[model samples]
Target: MSVAGEGAGVDTGTYRHAMGRLAKGVAVLTTTAGAQDHALTANSLTSVSLEPVLLLVCVETDARFHDAARESGVFGVSILAADQRALAAWFATPGRPLPGQMDRAPHHRAESGVALLDGCLATLECDVRDIHPAGDHSIFVGAVRAARLAADPKAALVHFRGQYSALT
Candidate 1:
């Protein structure tokens, strides 16, 4: 069985192209694993519930940061500002170490010891409560422990059609 309509095989390129049309706010997801910090550029974060303040983030199963976030049981989501395109690119690059990425941009540690990007439009520190396996990714459902908005909330970094955009 394939994960496509009517049992048809899903074309990877087509799926990527179709998904690219959906505009979404960019966020840098971060977590600390042991002595190392891990981060990834993500746009797949969304709220799941309000009473318990549950949210979910999708992480590729093969990504290095996936294990780090799973092991730590905590993650921080920094909603990127329009001017933070470079920071997003740095985190999205494969084989880029967290230290090297930090050299390009600075971040702070939350009370939970999760790495948080500075100058973001908003931030959320979450504690993982459950994980569900998706096709090629794992959906991590978490409870929001803390959240804050940036001092400047003028513009938000958005991604659409495979490019970075600003929604001011």
Candidate 2:
């Protein structure tokens, strides 16, 4: 391992290997702009502040949803429940059959017009506060406009060591 303060030795493979062991909740990030909807699976959701109800979700710069998010200035996050692994996988897929991925699943729109997936453990409608470039992704800082919890509670879907598991 490299010494602290020195950016040597650790490569992308090594970093990914280490981070892959961390358990993380999965969520689908969605945005709609110019009459088009986009969504992508992400595990990089986190609350940045509570006073303003701010949160952040990182989107790959190359993902289809990236431009839509930037243009829309609003997005939605649907935290997947344990049984929604298929939904998570579907959104994560690249070049997925079109007619739109949302067509393959049930979803609703937030007042801001962001698509919120049905059957999620929780959903948050957010307005983009800022965007920061980070490595190969862009971190979107959002202020939560509205939040909702599923009618029924269920275990969460988590990813660890390249696999999915239920947080029971």
Say what the RMSD of model 1 is.
Answer: 1.9
How does candidate 1 score on lDDT? 0.90
Cα lDDT for residue 30, candidate 1: 88
Residue 2: error of model 2 in Å?
18
Per-residue lDDT value at 152 in model 1: 62
Q: Rate the local accuracy (lDDT) of all candidates.
A: 0.90, 0.90
Give the alpha carbon lDDT tens digit for every residue of 18-114 in model 1: 9999999999998888878888999999999999899999999999989998999999999999999999998999987566566677788899998
How good is model 2 by TM-score?
0.93
Which stretches in model 1 have alpha-carbon errors above 4 Å?
A: 1-7
